[model samples]
Target: MQSLSGKTAVISGGAEGIGLALAKGLGALGMNIVLGDIEAKALARAQEIMTDLNIPHLAVEMDVSIRDDWQHTARAAQERFGDIHMLVNNAGVGGGMGALGNLDESGWRWAIDVNLMGVVYGADTFVPLMKGHGEDAWLINVASMAGMAGVPLAGSYTATKAAVVALTEAWSTELADSAIHVSVLAPAFVKTRIHQSHRNRQARYAPTTAPGPEVMKMAKGSAQAVENGIDPELLAKRVLEALDAKETYIFTHPKYRFVTDERSANIAKAFDSAAESPLVADVAEAPMALGFVDS
Candidate 1:
């Protein structure tokens, strides 16, 4: 986990942005790379980038949301490289931006499937393989700044990432005694073509001709944020540093620490004041809107 040298790592969504940046960093550390992406053209570009670096790699087309796709990707990685020492569940999307109440059922399902269940599928498919590889094997899941903090507009995306963060935490706790390490990357805004790419990818995978009217509006808002975010390379470096530290939560922005601290303090105060709390009996559960349901 300290260094990626000689390790065979499978990176989902490795075609561009943070995913490609992480692949390049790992490759520079002398790790063999297996890059998965649904976009053939972008995957080709990614392969070229790795080739320019003279790194050993294989770019495989994969849909992380699909169980069969994940299985095939794992098989392809094993066929090309040996046992995968690390699995990076980095493939994700930025769906149309909208309030939780406005999100459609399809958008909700898409967000949950791609952002949450995709990580689940990746873990189910690759963890067993990683587990057999002895200690030091790692699983890295990319969440977002919204994962820990609730953003008013991006309800679905925030929800999915929160799930990812929570799942990674539980998995880490469960596997603490094992050599396999589970970490989640919770980044703030990062410069990547994720929004456009997600929209484009969705178009390719969609069973319909085009998205609905409301969905298009959401997608546009998301694209704006993606085009104006921070650098992916910096996030990539942070990811490597976190891996070196064997840390569980890899936070991108230092400012986020304040938010986390405030949340923790509020929780502690609430616990201490539970007896005097006024609305404790009204708590109710409902299905959460998550992921990139915005687009």
Candidate 2:
């Protein structure tokens, strides 16, 4: 929709970080909010913040990875808000730090479950309601900058993001004729607790040992990069703008375009010369572990 005023929104992982930021932003725009998170304390804290802001909101303890959980969350949002206009599939976890080979099956699965499957569940659960309403609606899936490019270390994360991008593209095309609009947010970094998410991860996946020294060093750099990354409020604004524009691909920062542009140029040149880049092999070979498979 063009305006968020009086609209209803459900935000997965709304307890903290960018999720909470988007909730507050949408609330300030006069939207009714339903915030979901697995962490009770964080949910409570986020609710308190909403309360102080005089925003009408409800916090639900939810595990976005489960289909039943998403069903329940969708029902709860409709019950509380009367109608749902937006769904932000923002819940995600950093699986672990390592090369593709170093990432174990469990680690890979955990990342895919939360990062990829969570968004899938949210979209599959909410899109029907949005479509049924026959009103303007939006589905915003939070992918990552890594989703756009194959970074060296975060293999599992990149793979899941690629899935998200593909999903968003497919859904956007599929729903183009409908009132529901789909968009994917591929941000490089933002000041958030994603780095520490490894500590609070659920039982589905836990590395036996802490990230190795090399991994730790890379993670440190990544965290620092995020801390200096985009402002969450600004990102929130971009999200709303993307919804209004009906833009399928929502990118937060302009600086990140270099790699994407370089890759695109290479692809175009290869198309002209009948030669292709080897990046396809890396993408196809990246490990995909759904940590909750046995659960």
Candidate 3:
């Protein structure tokens, strides 16, 4: 999808951070924008930014995790711009910054709903529209390096992000024959307000359990990491380059690529052990049975 001029993009979490950076970058290329965010104040600020820049846009205050919200947002976007060409499922939260069992049920549920279900809802809502359009379309799901290299004390965040990465990979294959192209953005860290996400967390999802020292420490460290992270505009530029190349797995910070590589190596070693076992061939199903090609 080389040409973005005059195209329309729907970005969840478009009010700030990486999402807003992408909005600015894409709008610069003459694309119409639909900015959906849960924060009303931030959405208003984003709208002002769009108006100031003379970009074609509609800012919709909507929660990406809600299924009906997507329908409403779609209607608004289509009414304003018509035929969405890009969907960036970027709305997410930093949560469960502790060992898996330490956080209460609310923490887990909140993370699953926002971090994982948000992307699910976005894809379910937009993929059909994108397929109907013959022109080029792009689906960008923002994962994280934490998904690749699971960080301690962030069990929920890592799990949800890893799920997003897997979902993007599956959707990419499913949409391969269609006009919709998919890319999963996995960046190490970025200067964003994500660490302070609790400020916007809904009341229904408030925690019942008090976090332990480890959880508090994790939260503090995460805030520091975010403060020293790279500018989101740089990540946005990288995304554009990746989209131009139609790359499925968009990444940044090559110096940290070794982390994912190391994970891959560990996985391969385990697979090798299993494949070498004589019991493997006895129980293994044919590639066709697993919907896998025998290359």
**Candidates' C-alpha lDDT:** 0.81, 0.85, 0.89
TM-score for each prediction?
A: 0.85, 0.89, 0.95
Cα lDDT tens digits, model 2, 162-244, are: 88998998888778879887889998889888888876578867675455677878988988988898789889988878767
Best by TM-score: 3
The global Cα lDDT (0 to 1) of model 3 is: 0.89
> Model 3: per-residue lDDT, tens digit, 1-295?
4678899999999999999999999999999999999999999999999999999999999988799999999999999888999999999998656676666778778889999999999999999998887888899999999888778877888999999999988888778879898999999879999998987788888887888988888788879989999999999999998888888999887888899889999999998888888988467565585434556
Predict model 1's lDDT versus the native: 0.81
- What are the clashing pairs of model 3? none
Q: In candidate 1, what are the lDDT values of residues 59-114, reduced to their tens digit?
A: 99988888999989888889888899998999887643565456544555667888
Model 2 clashing residue pairs (backbone): 108-289, 109-289, 109-290, 109-291, 110-291
Model 1, stretches more than 4 Å misplaced? 1-3, 201-225, 277-295
**Candidate number that wins on TM-score, 1 or 2:** 2
